[model samples]
Target chain A: MYVNATLVAQLVVFFILAWFTMKFVWPPIVKALDERATKIAEGLAAAERGKQSLELASKRSAETVREGKEKVVELLVQAEKQSQQIIEEAKAQARIEADKVIAGAKAEIEQEAARAREALRERVADLAIAGAEKILRREVDAKAHADLLAQIKQDL
Target chain B: MATTGHEAAAHVPSAGDYIVHHLGHLNTTGHPQASVVDFSVINLDTLFFSVAMGVIGLLLMWVVARRVTSGVPGRAQAAVEILLEMVAGQARSIIHSEESRKFVAPLALTVFVWVFLMNSMDFLPVDLLPMLWQGATGNEHAYLRVVPTADLNGTLGMSIGVLLLCFWYNIKIKGMGGWVHELFTAPFGNHPALYLPNFLMQMIEFLAKTVSHGMRLFGNMYAGELLFMLIALMGMGFSSMSGVGGSLMWAGHVVAGTFWALFHILIVVLQAFIFMMLTLVYIGQAHEGH
Candidate 1:
């Protein structure tokens, strides 16, 4: 029925519920939304940080590859130079060894030729003295005189 | 009225009589026992309270707008501004239409204030003004219900107003024929066989919404008013009891009442705001045809 009591009672209950909703229910819902927003923000920030680190890592990797290439090039150059020097040293040593062997062989052949010439000279002198003595001693003998005269003429 | 000095006197009206009397409205016939809105006579209290509160709300908003400043505001101005901002924000989120919100937002805010004022009427001592009016008029029968929301007629009237707005927006947003066609063809294909099911579903939804909206407010306020009456009765024992018990009753009455009244203030404002927000949400939904 329509009465003042009913009006008053309804008002009381209505207000109580209104208060409960405003004070209790509304806040948590609002807070839940705010929390979600905050979480999204944090996630975006973390992703940005990860992106930055990735870029830095890529940059370092590129630099390392460049440095390695330079080192490889330098090692190649050094190896080539070392190999050229070894070749030159081996060729020079081989040429000097050939000259020494040729000089020793020529000296040995010249010494043998000198000895042969000296022996031949001594033998020729000794034979010439022996014919002259025989001719002086045997001049008186008949047939030996005639042969010694001929050998002396030929020697003169 | 029991909290007031005169009602503080121990006079315990019987529960049935108390409830009936409290339930009675201030009708033009000036009879406490007369049934207003009955098949016989009409109660003017519901109509009066609704119109009066509605006017008060409009006047308040108008006054606030008239005195609004671009600079720093006084406490009154600031409070009104905050209230306006809150109402507008809520309306914006719920309604999502600048055009409809032009009326709906302010209407929602008005509902909150008006309903809040209606609910706050319960704070008046139950018998204070009614008994005073009776005494002054020399009439043995004078029933007055100050709180408008306590009356089902008043609440139903408000809900009906909301329903009308819903229908209006539905027409404005989705044209008259479009809304009607959608009503028939919706939630199913445009087949003749499914029309009945769709129509029934639509009708049930609308009916359910209107009834529940009205009853939810009615039930809550009605229960609260009954509690005040019960508490009023407890204090009535202060006069009828003996020395020690009477004193104790009086003390308990004071303690319980002060506590309840204080708590009730918060309750009153909250219920109003909820009703207002719901109004906005419902009106917002109406913007979509389906």
Candidate 2:
């Protein structure tokens, strides 16, 4: 078998390159890739966390809006109830004052009516006395005339 | 230019002479290999050129490495770094064991660089060195083929080395008894009746793997060498021609040579990368007992 020098030389050179490059170049390269992969994983985790938080925030914001709306509605209902109560109170106060005024007017009217009735009775008695004197002759029994006046007054 | 060379090589020397001379290395002291493998008969030409190119590639990597920064890198570092990253990544994927990968990863890188440096030899002017040597030595018998990848012997030798590694790993990772037992009982039961068939199948598998692994490298190198020869023949034809055909020959040599060289760049890198990946894969397979 013919020996080949070229073949052996090539083998030597190849082994040398393999040794040198593997020692210096390949390790760092492999480490670089590992680093890049780790970074990507971390970035993905962060992004996932960010998305989760964003979702939670959005949900909370929606809940807050709903709560705010509910609060507003409750306040409006309370305002409406308060206004209704105030109106009812105003109406009750007006009714009480009106009842007091009507009672005072009725009492005053009754007292005035009693006084006018007394004055009208007195005038009627005077007219009856005058008419009796005119109808009778000059000297008649005063006691008998008084008795007739009383009867007339009683009959009127 | 190539056409001129084509006519010359087209003469088609007798097959015996052709094979012998083409296979012969232009040695330093008339002996190419050592006594067992002629050390003195060293193909100094190939060694000089191969080492020089290997250094250039290493220097290139080193320069790029020196330039590397944590910030946005330059194109050179980026490209080299990308290649380094790709090779390491592939090595990790193929050879899972960290201890094994320590060696295997470097093995793959060296495979790529050495093979690539060897492959780049095809780009040198085919006659430039040989003609120069003939002029300097006054002897035309100093025929040289520069590219190591173009040498089938070199490729086969490499494959053989890988085969040896595989074998060593297999035996080491799996004890001899385990290996033998697997040979006799695997894919078939441990039953006495199936032993023969199992052993035969197992033997065939080992033989097939070893043979194919070597042959694959041999075949690719052989084809690349043949193509270079053909291209060289074209250049010879152009030189011979003086008139129209001769001029067209020069033009044909140039155009075909340029296109082939450009396209060959892809083949060279691809072939190296493929061989490296396969080496990793085979080594990984060896790590497994079955």
Candidate 3:
């Protein structure tokens, strides 16, 4: 129990242990702790960045969908207008074709009527000449009948 | 008192003999003589056990440090990490200077663990190691004290180390001249009239702190060792008795031993922590200007 050589030996051991611990043990453990802290901070920052980008991407995708719907609606309206224009153009074309066909038929009928009348007038003039020959015999009235024939043709 | 082997055991010792036997140290010069001041004598048991415990503490720390991982920690790793954090936290609060803490924190940790290991040696049945020593060397009266902290020399040795650190920091933080000046001048008054009184008070304070610091641990642990010896004697007393009284005394011995051992767990750990904290606080105080 007295103050002796053991006390001095112990003090030396204490100093050596303290020095060894400070030199070797402490720095690495503290370094590990600090590294873990920095790693956790960086991980949290990365997670925050990912969350923000996810929100941005979701918003962008939503806007893209809305724009696509608007374009589809505009395309549908344009298609409807084009179909209406095509229907009106088809109706006008049919009316023009009908008018042309009716005009062609009227011209053909007028030509046919004129031919029939000329034939009938020629036959009537022949019959009149035969009756006059019976009434006034032979050559005396031939020269006067020429003017009557011409006047009869005009009346027909 | 120096007798060994079967001859020493042939005579049943008185209470004084038993206590004296337990108190004696295994010295470099074979048997330690009873002396109030024996500067040349080295207590071999104190040196052996202290170094052994110190090595064990260092090995435990080294293993934990080597296996430390950033990944999920195993139980051992986790336990060590918690201990490290606790020491770091105490050092951080007490010692503000980061540079000082690099040495002081680990020093505090070593002190705690080494003292704790030494205190825990009391948990071993008081007679176990000495009996083993007796059997091994065939010295029936072999003297060995396992609990290093129970030795006044050992505790005071550690406290002296702390005193040295305090002195170092005092000199480092305040220049040597400044520390000397403050030691004489600041605590009472700057006047020359108060210098002697202040210096005397300062010396007394240092002496008191160091003495109490070492004595407190030595007193507690020494008392515990004594209690264990007394309790063991109670069992020995009953072994000579017969019948129910003998059985009862045997049972009491076991019960009392178990109870004290359980309770001493708290004392051992608490004493170690208190010693470590006081060391840090003293050193921290040294770093501050008066």
True contacts kept of each: 0.06, 0.43, 0.69
What is candidate 2's CAPRI-style docking category based on DockQ?
Answer: incorrect
Candidate rank order under TM-score: 3, 2, 1
All candidates' chain B TM-scores are 0.88, 0.78, 0.95
lDDT per residue for candidate 1 within A41-124, as digits (tens), equals 898999999999999999999999999999999999999999998898888888888888888878877887777765665555
**Model 3 per-residue lDDT tens digits across residues A1-156:** 566778888889888878777766666666767777788899999999999999999999999999999999999999999999899899888888888888888878887788777788887776767766777787536577779877866775
Q: State the C-alpha lDDT per candidate.
A: 0.69, 0.70, 0.85
Error (Å) of candidate 3 at residue B163 is 0.6
lDDT string for model 2 (A1-156, tens) is 334556666666667766777677666555655666787789899999999999999999999999999999999999999999999999999999999999999999998997787667656876767666678645445586778766666665
lDDT of 2 by residue, B1-290 (tens): 22124545666443344344544556677634535554445566556666777778777877666555655567887787777768778987877788887888778776777777777776776556666776688875566656665554466557767777787777877888877787788778888899999999977876777557656655666576566556666656556557888777767777877887788778877787778877888888888865
Question: What is the C-alpha lDDT profile of model 3 across B182-251, one tens digit per residue?
Answer: 9999789799999999999999989998899999999999999999988786677564667998788778
- Candidate 3 Cα misplacement greater than 4 A, ranges: A100-155, B1-10
State the lDDT of candidate 1 residue by residue for B1-290, as single tens digits.
34334543544556577667777767655665344334344456665665566556556555555555444466765676667668868988999887776567656766787788888877877667667766786864567676777777667656667777788888999899988888889878688999999999988877887777777777777777777777777676766667988888878868878888888888888888878887887888888755
Show the lowest summed lDDT stretch of 10 residues, model 2 chain A. A1-10
List the DockQ of the predictions in order. 0.03, 0.20, 0.63
Q: Which stretches of candidate 1 lie over 4 Å from their true place?
A: A2-156, B1-12, B32-40
Ranking of predictions according to lDDT: 3, 2, 1
